[model samples]
Target: MRLALSGVSVRIDSSPIVAECDLTVEDGERVGLVGPNGSGKTSLLRTVYRALDPFAGSVALSGDDVTTLSQREVARRAALVAQDSTPDFDFTVEEVVAMGRGPWLRAFESTTGGGDATITAALERVRLADHRARRLSTLSGGERQRALVARALAQESPLLLLDEPTNHLDVHAALELLELVKDLERATLCVLHDLNLAAAYCDRIYVLHGGRIVADGPPAEVLDPELVRTVFGVTCTHLTHPVTGGLLLAFSPQQPVRSPHSVKG
Candidate 1:
């Protein structure tokens, strides 16, 4: 699936959260959205899944306007993995994944044979097949995130929207989760705070700032010291990894160097 946003803007209760933003995630591509806090990344993402209608412009999936599609139709085409998707109820992992079949079922209809197979396949894809009976609340943070991804997978949507899937995870877990996402090979639009991780995982990146997109391209072309200083107010050093030869960034506060002064006794 292909997602395209053209001149999209978002407002909440008369407060503008995003300006006219244009972005695209092609079929089977992993595109990353990165910016400082409150830059409207989440708001833009919400528009794609029809969670929040764009105040201006259009969001299209496979060239079909989102407004023209019903909520269930949209749900059938796009799946979302939100940052705060943890359930309060003690639902079993299998039950949680089964919810993804909702868009296909009619009123009061339960999942049948094929639906059960799909749910099981999703769990196996996330490597959670053995824990299908476990309560979601008892799983580790990374495991819970994977379960959510499994739910999205069960939705069988070609387009995926992920809002900071690595939040609250340790470094190793974060990398593991991103690796799993990369392996899915879905058309994904992901919001990420860690620029390095985005660079490593995303095929292309769009940089948002002040409710507008400032730069976008492959990670090697868009991420640079000057852009980092201007957009994030930090100094950045670019390095190449020895093993993978991927881009790495080291950042520091943009403080001035001070001359040394001697103190007299």
Candidate 2:
């Protein structure tokens, strides 16, 4: 699936949260959205899955306007793994993953045999099949996140939207989760706070600042040190990873503010 957001704006009550943000994730491509805190990355992601409607502009999935589709139809096209989406109730992992099949079943109808197969496959993909019988509350943070991803995978959608999926995870768990996401090969748009992870996993990136998209391109071109300093209010030294040969960002506390266009040469 191809996701296209044009002139999108979002508001909470009367206050604007996102403003005229335009971005895209092509079919089977992984795109990243990066920004400082309160920069509206989550708000922009909500618009894609219709959790929050855009007060202005349009969001389209594969040339069809999202507004024109019913909520169930939207779920059929896109699956979202939102930040902190775990249920408060102590549902078993299998039961939690079964929730993803809701769109395919009629109200009050039980899941078909095929749905069970899909749920099993999803749990396997996330490496949580052995834990399916366990209550969600017994799992660790990383395990819980993987369970949520299994739920999303069970939805069988072409497009995936992830909002800060690595928030509370340790270093090993974060890398494992991202590796799983990358291997899925779906059309994915992820909001990530860690610039180095985004640079390593995402094929392209969009930089958001003050509720608008300020810069976008491949990671190499978009993650310039000046751009990082300007948007994130920190000094960054760009480096290459010795093992993976990918972009690595070394950040320091905020330095004297400099204009993004300032040239040292």
lDDT values, one for every candidate: 0.93, 0.93
- lDDT of model 2, residue 98: 88
Candidate 1 runs further than 4 Å off: 112-115, 256-265
Cα displacement (Å) at residue 178, model 1: 0.7
lDDT of 2 by residue, 161-221 (tens): 9999999999999999999999999999999999999999999999999988999999999
TM-score of 1: 0.95
Best by TM-score: 1
Question: Clashing residue pairs, candidate 2?
Answer: none
Count of backbone clashes for each model?
0, 0
Name the top lDDT candidate: 1
Per-residue accuracy of model 1 over 1-265 as CA lDDT, tens digit each: 8899999999999999999999999999999999999999999999988889999999999999999999999999999999889877898999888888899889998864434889999999999999998999999999999999999999999998999999999998899999999999999999999999999999999999999999999998899999999999899999997878999999999997665664344
List TM-scores for all candidates, in order: 0.95, 0.94
> Which consecutive 10 residues in model 2 have the weakest lDDT in total?
106-115
